[model samples]
Target: SQQGEEDPQALSIQEGENATMNCSYKTSINNLQWYRQNSGRGLVHLILIRSNEREKHSGRLRVTLDTSKKSSSLLITASRAADTASYFCATDVRARVTETSGSRLTFGEGTQLTVNP
Candidate 1:
């Protein structure tokens, strides 16, 4: 499968600590995106890194992509209790040579993070 697989299926940390999660995927991809889900809520996009992008940052979130290794990592700096959520990595692969609408995203199993106050 072309879906991504996240490492460290679960994490527990106190408030103000940093949380790091890693994801690895099979097959070539057009882009990789990170998302966060709070308990029963739907996923919210955190960052999107194209195949050409090595790294990107948004607020306290940092995402890194290594196409050569087919892997990606997400770092949450100084996490708060509100940062508790499940993080997932999704991959967008090229569907076919003639398709132009973009392929559907395949999501990883996700990493559950618990930030205790």
Candidate 2:
């Protein structure tokens, strides 16, 4: 079963505004990661939060996790037109005790953010 499903399929905001996105998942995970993708480009890793961590920040971005609720959120401050892009949340699920290959990652559907200048 895949985990990490994002909420709010899309969002629109003006420059300097803030953007927030949420994701929910099923099953236990080792970590959660966020990624951003510009139009016609590949995804770029933004941040990663371990299952034990509750919050993290990087530059204009803030991420929060609530393991009790199996959810996470990403907030981008002072949004710019250049910030318009799609954001996704990914989960690294813990492998079975017998499995040795490695962990598996499941990605969310993604939230499309449009920041108007």
Candidate 3:
């Protein structure tokens, strides 16, 4: 598949600890993004990093990319109970010659993250 796949479809962490997740893809991409979804809310965009960028950080969240291995990782430091949610990695792949320039993301099943108090 040309989509990104995240491992360990679930994770649990303490209120003041860290949580880490990994994603792997099969095709070249223009960019990748991480999003979070609360139990009953819309997905929230966390961060986006281009294929050329190696790393990016937002607040307590950190992301790393390795094009050579077609993989990426997300780390949340000092995770809080409020951080409990499902996380998804999305990628904008290169469109086909006959296709348009825009590329829609194919989401993984997602990781259900729970932060305990």
Q: Best-fitting candidate, measured by TM-score?
A: 1
**Each model's lDDT:** 0.92, 0.92, 0.88
C-alpha RMSD between model 2 and the true structure: 2.0
Once superposed on the true structure, which residue ranges of model 1 sit more than 4 Å away at CA?
96-100
lDDT of 3 by residue, 52-81 (tens): 999999999999999999899899999999
User: In candidate 2, what residue range of length 10 has the lowest lDDT sum?
Assistant: 95-104
On the 0 to 100 scale, the lDDT of residue 77 in model 2 is 98
Error of 1 at 73 (Å): 0.2
Pick by TM-score: 2 or 3, better one: 2
Alpha-carbon TM-score of each model against the true structure:
0.93, 0.92, 0.91
**lDDT per residue as tens, model 2, 7-114:** 889999999999999999998888899999999999999999999999999999999999999999999999999999999999986774235566668899999999
Q: How many clashing residue pairs are found in candidate 1?
A: 0
lDDT of 1 by residue, 1-117 (tens): 537999899999999999999999998988899999999999999999999999999999999999999999999999999999999999986664245566688899999999999
